[model samples]
Target: MASQAPSRVGKTLIALIKIGLYLFVLALVALVVAVSVAVSQLPSYQELVRRDDLGQMIRVRAADGSVIHSMGPSFGEWLSHDEIPAIMRDAMIAVEDRRFHYHPGVDPIGIARGIWVGWTRDDRVRGVSTIAQQLARNIFLTNDRSMGRKIREGILALALERRFSKEQVLELYLNRVYFGGGAYGIDAASRRFFGHSATELNAGQAAIIAGLVKAPSNYSPTADAEAARARANIVLQLMVREGAISEAQARAANPQQVEFVRTAERHNSARYFTDWVLPQLETLIDETVQPIDVWTTLDVGLQRAADEALNANAPSAQAQGALVSLDRDGAVRALVGGRDYVDSIYNRATQATRQPGSAFKLFVYLAALETGYTPTSTVVDEPVTINGWSPRNDNGRYQGPVSLRAALALSINTVAVRIAQDVGTRTVADMAQRFGITTRVDTNPSMALGTSEVRLIDLTRAYASVAQRGVAVVPYGIRRVTTADGTLLYQHRSDESRVLVAPWVAAQMTDLLQAAVMTGTGRAAQLGRPTAGKTGTTSSNKDGWFVGFSSGLTTGVWYGRDDNRALPGLAGGRAPARAFHQYMARAVANRPVENFEIEVALPDWQVEPDAESWYGAPDDYQLVDPDGNPIQPVEDGPPPPPQPREPGSATTEELNQEWLDHAIGRNRAPQAVPQERRGPPPDRGPPPRRQQQEVMPPLPGQRQSAPPVVRPTETPPPTIRPRAPGTAE
Candidate 1:
């Protein structure tokens, strides 16, 4: 019986051996088929290396030539084996594949260890990909985890090893692997994260980059810096254990010292600006261009300021604010489209159009000045029905028979409507268009009160024209576009600006606007400099605006709810003006103080009956002397003798008459009149006794002085007038 049992056992063992052998052969056949198919479909090594299918990469740079954003795969200069730092290579090899130098394309030891650990731990299998295998998968295959994909990856890795040396394989792997933040290759990753070249990377920086190969987004420093640093520490430990780096060296490599080129917050803040400029690239460059660099007019510092101010000063949690800043030449310096770009990408500054309210009064008053109405011209602020629609003052009270300067300073809706009725709303619309308001303007009388919807960018550009002294302004962002190889594709050219408004008319409008900021609703926008701007508030407080210029920078701010719901008490003088002040305070901190060119003299009439002048008491106003100092008070005594008037010198009344005659097409030829006539009369002497007595009053301890003399050659600085009590918009 024992002999029979032995024989049966031997037979069962042979049968088991035969079944095992057959299964092994069947698996071998399947692997062969998969490898053969993968080989047949594999691209040539040259094709994989060329990477011709990569998407067009766009790098947007600020005016200061710093990279602000990148779209699509970002690749840096191709680095050779010797060009790559030894620390980077060692870190990569130690963490990615310890036996990379001694193993074939497939690492049996790594695979076996990974399988045993995964089985014993009851977890998902750990990655056992060698550098060559990773390179093959990245360049030529998908990241599928099926057995078929594994066989193909192995075959492709073996083929790559056969075609290239170990050094070449490592170089290709390091140069072609993906890092986070749209970056590919070690060079791009280094420059993107460290703002430098790959050759300058230290051990910690190298380790940080090396750890990204397993999962790019999961360990991105910009996204989750703590996790990234932790992964980097693991890489350093691996390098130390691999004998590639000493323990002390690993300890010396601090991941905290690695500073990113840009903070995550700054990057997100600039995204709005970049997104606005990106779509313009297709029109600026040829469609066939593969990769290009766009140089924009964005000032990073000003952009930061704008973002901070808008976010910090937004009136309400539900409201959104937009800011647009431009240089005198109309180059966009800073733009913030919305409160938070991530929550919503709707760019309120450039895309959203809202009612400008009284801010639209600029066009109405500018049209009036062009038609010969001086700042001191009388305009009655009375209740009047126009087509059954009555436009009342914002404060529900009107100053009867107010001067144009006072009317605008107080933002009186009735006076603006009266002036618009006389000047014609079509003329007002045309004047606005001529000054760079691209939006459609209504011809209705309510347009005088800014009922017409307009974009913040267009409104801001119009103000820039005034700042530029009547020169047309075309707001532009892209300064230049170039190919990756530095071939110029597009360069912005400053075309000869056509005069839209007469320089003298612009100066007069500026004078009125300066008064508005000094003693009116815009008093909150004071910058301790010669600033001129206007305040606007739509009905029900749905929209608020402050648009002004100082130090050659023109900025506009808009605040409102995106849903167009009314904010109970919001006004342009409150949130929007404060934001404008905050941003311009930082933007023009280093700029030299510049005075507005006031060619025409302010009227002798009191701008506001009860309000004091910016400098002092209403009757104590004095002009700056030839040396730019305020005229000092003299002891009570006889006034100085009046100086003789110069030849061709005319009184304020004569200049107004001439302007009216020119507007009405009188016999005098328009071109025959000199442009100098539009300015103050040739710095003539003081006015006559009657005019002096009416315009100037004696100080408490001194006698009366001559009326303020404005030299035609010297531009006068704007005054920071006090806000009148009981005045609100």
Candidate 2:
């Protein structure tokens, strides 16, 4: 029985051995078939080497040729294997793949070690991909975890090893890897992180860049410098172990001391200007033109100045501000869309349309000037009603009669409406459009008060046209566009500037604006030079604006809450004007003092009354005695037949005092006196009827009558100065 049991066990052992041999043969056949299929489905490695799949890139440069921004994947110039620094190559290989030179596509030792560690630890497996395999996966394969993708990756890696030299494969890997911040390739990464080309990278910078390959965002210096530095120290130790650098060199390499070129926060404002300019690029050049260089008109210095000014003068935490600066030819030199572009990228300068307030009066006054109204033309500033809507002055009180220049300078709402009424609102709307206001302007009476919405950029450009002396200005940002190789794709060619207003009219308007900045509401915007601008305050202080020009530069500033809520106590002459002053003070510090060509003469009606003359009488004439009694003349012949006074002939002192009274809130109507006296009241039969006299002809669309008062007793009559040839008195 024992012999029979031994025979049975031997027979069973032999059958199990035959079964194991058949199973091994079957598995080997399946493995060979899978390898063959993966190889057959592999993409062309030659195409991957060329790297033609990278999308287009756009580089925006400032006027001084400094790179302001870059969009899309940024790649540095392709470097040959010899041009790459030896230290950089060694740092990368020591950290990424230590056996890169010895491995032929697949490293069996590395794979075995990775599998053993993963099995023993019972954790996620670590990658054992060599440089060639990584390159193949990046170029020709998806990152799927399926066995099919790994099979394809291994096959392509083997093909690359057979076709290219080891140095060529390493070069390809260095150029194809991403190091964060939109940079691809070692050269770009070096420039992005260190602000220099790869040729200038030292040991510490090379270590930092090499460490980024493991997890770019996690080790990005810009995002977390401490973590990146710690990772780089590991790479430095690896380099020392690989004999690429001595231990003393590794110890001396201070990755913590490495300074980044610029943080994202430092260049965020430039992004606002570039964002505004980028949309215009597509319209300026062909869409298919890949890798373009847009040379914009932005002056980085001026842009920084503007940013500083806005930050310093922004009214409150809730209040936002925008600024737009343009050359006389309408090149956008600086544009700040908001107080903080990171918080909101709405681009208030070029995109948001808000009521410009009294700033739109520039167009209305320009229209009036073109319609034959001189700066000294007479206009009534009393309360005016149009279609049941009455516009009031900033101060509740009104200056009864003011010159066009003073009216505009003071931003008198009723005066603007009256002038618009005389010139026709359509003319004002057309004038605004001609001056480069792109938004639609309402033709209602309130349009003169700038109730229509307008972009800050368009308003600034409109003022620029006036600064250019009647020449039309089309605002532009891009000065030139070129390909990556400096081939010109598009260049801005200014067309012959069309004449929007007569030069003399522009000069007259400029004179009015100068008066605004010199002695009126825009006084805060004065740069101690010949400045021309206007102050604008909307209803309830919802918006404030200051658009002005000096030294051949026109800048406009706006301050308001983004939610359209009123800023308590906000006015155009306040924060906006101060910001304008601060920005212009820095922007034109180096520019030579330039003066506007103000050739228009003041109207005869605006002539100052002689200091010695009493009641506008001749020097020899006398009206009253020092005791307040009328001095009867020796021989007065019917008072010399009542001389006619010119329109708007109020003495300069009286007009100035009236303006002062209105500004100081002292413009109250005279109080009626009681008939009762301290002693006995004098008995009066009746009040005498008021006598009227025709003093001057009516203004363009309204009448003017002298206030009924007793004339000077027996004094020489006032003389009439002949009006100028083209005067609108």
* TM-score leader: 2
The sequence of per-residue lDDT tens digits that candidate 2 reaches over residues 1-729 is: 989998999999988988888888886677566555655665554555445556778899999998888888888867778989998999999998899989987787888888888888985456678898888887777778777777777777877776678988888888888898788899989988998889888999999999998988999887888888999999999999999999999888889888888755743677788988888876887755367789999999999999999989888889999999998778889999988877888899999999888998999888877655667666656754444455677677878768888888888877777677666678889999988888898776667788789999999988988888778888888999998889998889875447777665688899999999998999999998899999888888889999999999999999999899988878999999999999999999899999889874322221332211212235454544334454444463432443457798822222343443454455644232211101111122111211222223232333245232121111222222211111000
- Tens-digit per-residue lDDT, 284-320, candidate 1: 7784536788999999999989998998888889989
* The best candidate in terms of lDDT: 1
How well does candidate 2 score on lDDT at residue 83?
88
Q: Count backbone overlaps in model 2.
A: 0
TM-score of 2: 0.75
In order, what is each prediction's RMSD in angstroms?
Answer: 15.1, 18.2
List the candidate 1 regions with Cα displacement exceeding 4 Å: 1-54, 102-129, 145-159, 190-208, 222-262, 266-268, 287-291, 311-318, 342-344, 600-729
Q: Mark the 10 consecutive residues where model 1 has the least summed lDDT.
A: 710-719
